[model samples]
Target chain A: MNMSISEIEHEIIEEFGVFENWVDKYDYLIDLGKSIPKINPIYKTDENTISGCQSQVWLHAKCENSVIVFTADSDAIMTKGIVALLIRVLSNQKPEKILDAKLDFIAKIGLEEQLSQTRATGLSSMIKQMKIYAFAFKEKL
Target chain B: MSNKNNIQSLFPILKSSVNNNKLVYLDNAATTQKPNSVIAEINKFYLKENSNIHRGVHHLSQVATKKYENSRLVTQNFINARHSHEIIFTKGTTDSINLLASSFGQLLKKGDEIIISEMEHHSNMVPWQMCCERSGAKLKIIPCNKIGELDLDMFNQLISNKTKIVSVTHISNSLGTINPIRKIIEISHQKNVQVIIDGAQAAAHVKLDMQKLDADFYCFSAHKLYGPTGVGVLYGKENLLNLLPPYQGGGEMIKDVSLLKTTYADLPHKFEAGTPNIAGVIAFKKSLDFITETGLGNIKTHEDKLLDYATEKLNSIKGLKIIGTSSDKSAIISFIIQDIHHYDLGLLLDKMGVAIRTGHHCTQPIMKKFKISGTSRISFAYYNTIEEIDHLILAINKAIKMLS
Candidate 1:
């Protein structure tokens, strides 16, 4: 609950220095996806599926000590990587805090302008699903 | 003999020095490039004869109406339909399917069943899904084999007395498997079930004879057949269409509007409401003309060669896997390389000026059956040559090397 979001952002940016073009930036994003721990297979089922995505993605999150910790996986590797990036940015936070989080992290990472409309939509849907979880968790809290 | 040199010359895209580079367009499955003659006909419509059809008293309107009606007759002849009245102009194949589903689907009872195949595109599948959901009717699927061919025995076993509608694709866009539509129709008709054939993929490559096939409803998109977008044809037997209620209520589809009772227009007009895609409908004739000029047989021969050449080249690459190998396929070849993602491969291929379709191709059910996330598809048209296939092969080889 006391985690510094900006500190994590600074570390990510510092770890992968600013690149010349979007191509280099995408490699960094892909690397960001690779760094996250893989989601467990048991949590992946029909209940956790996203409707609009072309791939089968599953996400599981639990609140421990008032901190939201999330785990996600996908049948698609890149999509799994995408979910990992999403989990890094969105998870392990309170419901209100997660709901108020800025989605401009995509632009900060240089993916907003670089990714195609289809890929952007997929990312947007993942964010929406996370928000849905936040809203559901908010009521219980 | 049709020389390869002359055949290449026929396609202006191959010859035109655009941006000082030869355009290697491989997105033929999406929509094909139009010939100069077709372009001129469209231009002539806007320049010389441009007016509203059916309701106009002016000379230009008369010409436009004549052309529009003539296009219908031409399309009817092309598909060998019983009458021009059966050909209803729609926005696209999606619109045609939606219209049928909304109207005929409303007639289905709670326990009634509708059958579809696994190889259907989303347009064919989604409408039926919605239809069954709305009507409380059960939906059944005829499973496709690993080779992407339909299991005919499974199809026959699925047919029962409670089955009200049976819809299937004439050809698989992702697999290029040409289905046995006639046999399916016969099987469905035996149980008094109506058959709707989604001809979106088949219309471009194979010839259609609606009467011979005896399908109750046949739908296709004009854009898929080298014609303009925003226009398609829905062919239904006269009696069946009459039996089904009107889909949309609007102008031109009404016989009389009254406070007490309203009567609908007859035949195709009842299905077609309001002002249709006039320009797209008019230009579609030229596309059909182009096909007639080149001949469907000639077009099929050209595309088959390209498919063969591309398949052989792609197969030679190490670690590459080809999906959907049916003996009776058209011109679609879908594949993926081991350990390399399809999207990554597509991005690399595009940089080399080769366009290909990547991902599920709106056939998620088929993707689920294959147990893979997705595959990269290279679909061919009549104008495509072996040289482009070679370029595709080279680009794919380079892409795989970059990833590995």
Candidate 2:
């Protein structure tokens, strides 16, 4: 059985709750970044790249059996780690469910600053792009 | 407390903490923290003397105008310009360059050439490209060598009868390589072509004398010199300023307005359009005073020491390579650690309360020449100490270990 978006978010929150210090949290994030499956080189095209990020990020999405799957990569590891966390919750979900996902776990995990407009990380843009893909796929269905 | 501590205390921001650690501000090249005196002046201006300058009979207006003009004079003395009228208040270095490009660019025709270097900031480079696009002029580049220094041989060959003006940065914001402006000015003048020095990075670090350097026009921002933002200075030779057309027309920059023909105001006013940043301009005098009291020679010595100390320590780290190794570099160090991304290092360091700039430092061409996306940069001011550099080194080591 697959977990719902909220369940996965709760699991992430519980996992992050164990770390008392920023260093430990960041170290775990870096480890997660290392473990995340690499995006296929064929999918990393200019059309798939998200702009406004200090570091380049490529995101690709497709719908299979009414479920949307996302594959993404970033040259910067920290950003890639955040992308991995995002992909975990949003990918492999129905288009309507992906569109309605709250994504409150980012703030709950203390990574809210990355979503701020001031931060050049473009985490917010990544989330938006995911939703846009879901919306487009939803129209097709 | 030591003398350095005393100086650091004057900047209240230095006492603040980031992420539960003391702020180790190494981003001085982006902008300097203001001294208490400069901050107080801004408050005083807004609280007491708030009025529009020029063409006012009110007492407050007269006082405001006097203070504003006094700042222009202070700026004149700061850069050792021949006349106060030669100094025009601008929005910032970028604004000043755009103004020059629009006005001076009007003189260019088809087949004329303008020379710039490979290491210019986007502010200095883009304006000329736009100018060339509008006019039928050509843009020529002075190539940079392996060490980030300009190839003077190529520069000489590039300059010819068709070259109208040569504009280059006084110091590379990315590489920190201090270009020999005196030599560049002399070379350009031999061909009877004018030169504009983009002194945005150099103004705070070096002593500038317009008459001594003899550049046709020089530009810089006040925020980098510990003043408020939105204030910049454009120093041009009086004869040259007289020849160029006005950049913008508004209330202050006009002397007479007729239905058909409107005569423009004189030299400085002609260039200064709109009400301007009055409070910023007035408060900038305090920053100039602060620099004057501290002595440029002493500031340079302190910063040079910090640069040398940081360079030696950073080199000891394995897989770390320092870019822009010119012997005549400023207090900025741009470095890349092998297998560690610059953005990751920057994010980790920021978590540790070490603020350093990462990316191309607004010089993308130099990064292309280097064949890298970006490098981490740490720039120093006089208030920064040797201890802070040590903190940075420790943070970098910790960040690298975590990443690896």
Candidate 3:
């Protein structure tokens, strides 16, 4: 079954359980991070550094035979995972399609508001980075 | 040992877990976790003693005002200021430094110079940059050595009659370099230059007596010192603060409010501007109490041990290069692994329940100096243990293996 953002978020929220304890919350975050697709090491380079993030991130995308493929990595685990999720949702899709995709799709997963402000900002930077990459790739194509 | 147990007891954050692994919090330079006593003090203020400070004449207000003033006294004592009036409440170190820049910067003439160091946090650097840009003053940088320590010889060469201010950080957030501030202050004094120290990273671990340091001004955030985020201390010499115009014109900072003729309040109140972070300020004292009670010497010792332990372990790993290997480091270990991006390393470490800081650390110039984009930083606090260092070493090795 193909899982939508909402479905995945719901599953995560349900499985993540309570935040009465900080440990549980961190576990849920790490688990969520681990679920993202791992970016290949070859793509990690100077071209993908996002300004304002405490972690170093490299995002690489290509319109390989008209199927957009994104490869990314970060020095942070949660950020890495977050980028993975972004790639899953945005990568291998038409630049215009991905560009027009609503960011609310993330919130619908119930995961958007749940992250810390720093984490949220990091995710936003990643999304912005991806979109920039998409624009560059589209122009090249 | 007494200090260790007391400090551990105060901060329950030490006992917490991160992810599935034991939490190894090594990002102390960013901000420290609040102790239970401080947290309780904050809650108590909110729960029972909630009231507007200073202006209010009600019972609760009196209590709050008293408490707030008491906190001011505590801060004044902490920094060893001559008078509590020298201690102005601020949002944080950033706000206080900005306030000075905005007011005092307006007076700086063209060709004037404000000397800063290579190791300042963005909070300390940006305001001076803006001040120089606005006033046509020159921004002179005191360069750091390859080891990340400030070049005192370069500093001597840079400071001249034109040098109006020489601002620097007491302890670098990214490099963990502990600057020789007394010498810096002495040299600046010789040039008759005002000195503003960014003590945000130093306040918790360093012994700071403003009179002894002889700094014209000192700024530090409460959050970095295990206190609340919204309150900070700005200890300015009375003579200097009085000469500089108020940063923001508003209520509580003025005596008579007429658009035609507004007379400003005296000393600290003149700079305060508006209703301060009352609760945060009052509760902040408890954090100071926790720190004072712990004794900076003991804290330094504990943290040094942790830093040495972590450095030894991390250095042992192959292909690992420790960044900012200054002779004088304050519990911060910033490093990079060859053939692996800091992003990958940070992510893997988090999975292992280790929280570290990564990236350029807001000092792009320093990063450019090193010819690297960023490094992974694991800053230590007194609460962090040797065992946490062990965990971090293991995690780093594992992450390297996984990524490579």
Candidate 4:
């Protein structure tokens, strides 16, 4: 059976809770970043890019079998790692479900600072874009 | 204990911690941490002498006016300007440049050229570009070579009869390359072209003498020199200041007003239109006193040592490339690793309680010249210690290892 959005978020929080220090937490993030599949270069266009970030981030989303899948990339590995965590929580879910998801796991995992608009990572923008995609897909249905 | 310890102790923020670790602030170029004296002076202003300056006949007004004017005098002596009246209070370096551009652009005509270097901060560049757009004038750039030094030979050629002004930074904020302003002034003056020196980066690092430099105008922000924000100085030649139109017309800047016509005030006052940052300006004097008591020469010597030491240590790291390699530099280093991005490095460093600036350093043109997006930069002030540098190196190494 497919897990709910909160279930996935809970799973992530539990996985991150194992780390004792910031270094280990960041190390795990870096590993998650490395494990994420490479996004297609074809989808990496200026239209897909997000501004207001120190590092360049390209986010692309498409609906498959009424489920949304998010693909994203960043020049900075730390940002890429954060993006990986976000995509893992939001992707492979229904568009309506994705749109309704609160995704509070970011704050629970102590990554709330990255959600600040002023942060260089632009993780907040990435999350916003994911929801925007869900909303657009939801409208079509 | 060394005098450095005493100086560091004066800044209470230096003793603070971040993220469960000691905060090693290396972002002095953005803004220096305030000292106890400057902070106290600001507090004392609000507590004792809080009033609008230059207008009221009340006793508090006179006291506020005197303190504000006294700060201008302190700034005049700080930079060794010709007269106190020549020093106009501004918001900061960017505001000073914008004022100059708006007023000075009035003198320009079609086809008139304004020369600037590639390494100018956006503060210096954007204002001139706006002025050029307004006046139908052309902007000329003095190219920076691979090593981040301005091509002086090309600078000589860029100057022409059409060139009205040549503006350059005293010390580059991103690269830390110290431009030869004396030579630039001499060259521009011979051609009857006025020069404006952006002394924002140099004010804290160098001893400025406006007479010796003979630059027509010099601008610097007080915040960079351990003073409060929202306060800066624009020092212009007295006669030249008299010629340009007032930047803004308001209560303090006017001599007399009638229904028919209005006349402006004298040099300094004519430019300081509205009620200025009274508390910040008054507090700035204490910062000047702090710098004077500590000694600029001693600060320079200490910072130079830190720069050299940090440079040596940073060079040893594998895959790290320093962007600015100029022999003459302030206590700043901008570098990028082979694989690790600056954003990643900066985030990890912050987690370890190290604060360093990352990205374009507001000189996107310099980044473009180098064909890179941005760099991780660390700038040092007098209060920074060698131990802090070691900590920064350790943090960087750990961050790199994790990323790898």
**Top DockQ model:** 4
Interface C-alpha RMSD after superposing true interface residues, each candidate, one decimal: 3.3, 1.2, 5.1, 0.9
lDDT measured at residue B344 in model 1 versus the true structure, 0 to 100: 63
RMSD of 4: 1.1
TM-scores vs. true structure, each candidate: 0.82, 0.98, 0.83, 0.98
- For candidate 4, write residues A73-103 as lDDT tens digits: 9888878888888888888899889888898
Tens-digit lDDT track of model 3 for B1-404: 55455667778777777666767788888889999988998899999999987898899999999999999999999989999999999999999999988897889989999999987888888998999889999999999988899999999999999999999999888888999999999999998999999998899988889888899999999998889998988899999998999999888899887769999999889988878888899989998898898789988988888888778888899999888888788988889888777866776688789998878888888888889878899887778777667788888887776665
Q: Write the per-residue lDDT of candidate 4 for residues B1-404, one digit (tens) a residue.
A: 28678888999999888999989999999999999999999999999999999878999999999999999999899889989998999999999999999998888889999999999999999999999999999999999899899999999999999999999999999998999999999999999999999999999988888989899999999899999999998999999999999888788888999988989998889999988999999999998998888788988999999999999999999999999999899988999999988988998899999999999989999999999999999999999999999999999999888989
Clashes of 2: 0
Question: DockQ of all candidates, in order?
Answer: 0.20, 0.73, 0.29, 0.81
lDDT scores of the candidates, listed in order? 0.80, 0.93, 0.81, 0.91
Name model 1 segments beyond 4 Å from true.
Answer: A1-52, A55-121, A125-141, B1-23
Write out the backbone clash pairs for model 4. none
DockQ of 1: 0.20
The CAPRI classification for model 1 reads as incorrect
Docking class of 2: medium
Q: Which lDDT value does model 3 have at A123? A: 63
lDDT of 2: 0.93
| Model 1 lDDT, residue B164, Cα | 92
- Candidate 2 residues B1-404, lDDT tens each? 18899999999999999999999999999999999999999999999999999978999999999999999999999999999999999999999999999997888899999999999999999999999999989999999999899999999999999999999999999999999889999999999999999999999999999989999999999999999999999999999999999998788898899988789999899999899999999999999999999999989999999999999999999999999999998988999999998989998999999999998888888999999989999999889999999999999999999999
- TM-score of chain A, cand. 3: 0.67
Candidate 1 per-residue C-alpha lDDT over B1-404 given as tens digits, one digit per residue, 9 for 90 to 100: 25666766655666654223366677777777776666677788999998888888999999999999998999999999998999999999999999999997879889999999998899989998999889999999999999999999998888899899999999898888889898899888988999999999888898888888899999999888878789999999989988989999888889999988779999889988888888789889988988888889998988888888888888999988889998988889989789877866765566566778888888989998999878899898887778778778877887676555
Residue-level error in angstroms, candidate 3, position B39: 0.9
Ranking by TM-score: 2, 4, 3, 1
